[model samples]
Target: MLETRIKTRSDLKGLLMDAQDLFRDATTATGSKADELRNRGLNLLDAAIEKAQDAQSAAVSTSKEFAQSAGEYVRENPWKAVAIVTSAALLASLLARRRD
Candidate 1:
């Protein structure tokens, strides 16, 4: 009877060791998956930042071209440009006052 009890206890210890090893393997797998997800998120954010920078550069270039064209037009037609600008300013002030 004593021998049988000792065998049973040893079996239980072996089973416990197997369960611990399985748990450790699962934990390692989960940690690796989490790290992969974190890296993917960072990559997506970097791509978005690069896209935004490109868009900002394009907008600045377009604005500069528009300013140059408007300046040339005003130089060519000074009176007409002055009248258009005054009317626009008056309309804008009226709209601002109404909003306030």
Candidate 2:
């Protein structure tokens, strides 16, 4: 039932927010519980943020690698790449004319 109350990400976020507020204002028994929950939630949030940054970094690195490789390929076969693109554009234009 308690876990069901936090069935979604938004619900968990609300819980974390409440815990933070309690920890901020607590001076009673609730303070200890609030502190524990707040710390755990903060840890989870920090770990998630770290993993996301790592994934983003990896994606950017991969994209740069792909772009560099593609550039090298184009440089190594400039005329062939140009002819292929030109042929595709010509075919597209011809098809569009027929459609009109």
Candidate 3:
């Protein structure tokens, strides 16, 4: 099986769902083959969970860095940031109105 990069929330949800389904089947299985399959599933689920935790930690760190950098930039250029935000909000509102 190919490992996928869980970069988005949707990807994480999908991985969790897959792991859950496998676990559900594993619990109901019997005999040596079933035991083998269950062990494989457990290993896969464990790896996926570890990877998810690592990704979450990395994401949190990256987001904090980005926010700190953005805060510094905005503090140095307050007016520019305000103007940009105002323009973006205005454009979003206009787009919403057009959709309505």
- Best candidate per TM-score, number? 3
Candidate with better lDDT, 1 vs 3:
3
Q: Where does candidate 2 have its weakest 10-residue lDDT segment?
A: 1-10
lDDT tens digits, residue span 26-62, model 1: 5566677756655555554555456556556766787
Q: Which candidate number maximizes lDDT?
A: 3
lDDT of 2 by residue, 7-90 (tens): 444445665576566556544437568677567757766655665565567667878999999899899999988998999999
Q: Which residue window of length 10 is worst by lDDT in model 1? A: 15-24
Q: Candidate 3 — which residues are off by over 4 angstroms?
A: 1-32
RMSD of each: 25.0, 9.3, 4.9
Question: Can you write out model 3's per-residue Cα lDDT over 1-100, one digit (the tens) per residue?
Answer: 0133435445667666777777778778878867876777777677677778877787788789999999999999999999999999999999999998
At residue 2, what lDDT does model 2 achieve?
32
| Poorest lDDT segment (10 consecutive residues) of candidate 3 | 1-10
Q: Show model 2 residue runs off by greater than 4 Å.
A: 1-29, 87-100
In order, candidate lDDTs are 0.68, 0.68, 0.77
Model 1, C-alpha of 52: deviation from truth (Å): 0.8
Model 2 error, position 99 (Å)? 9.6
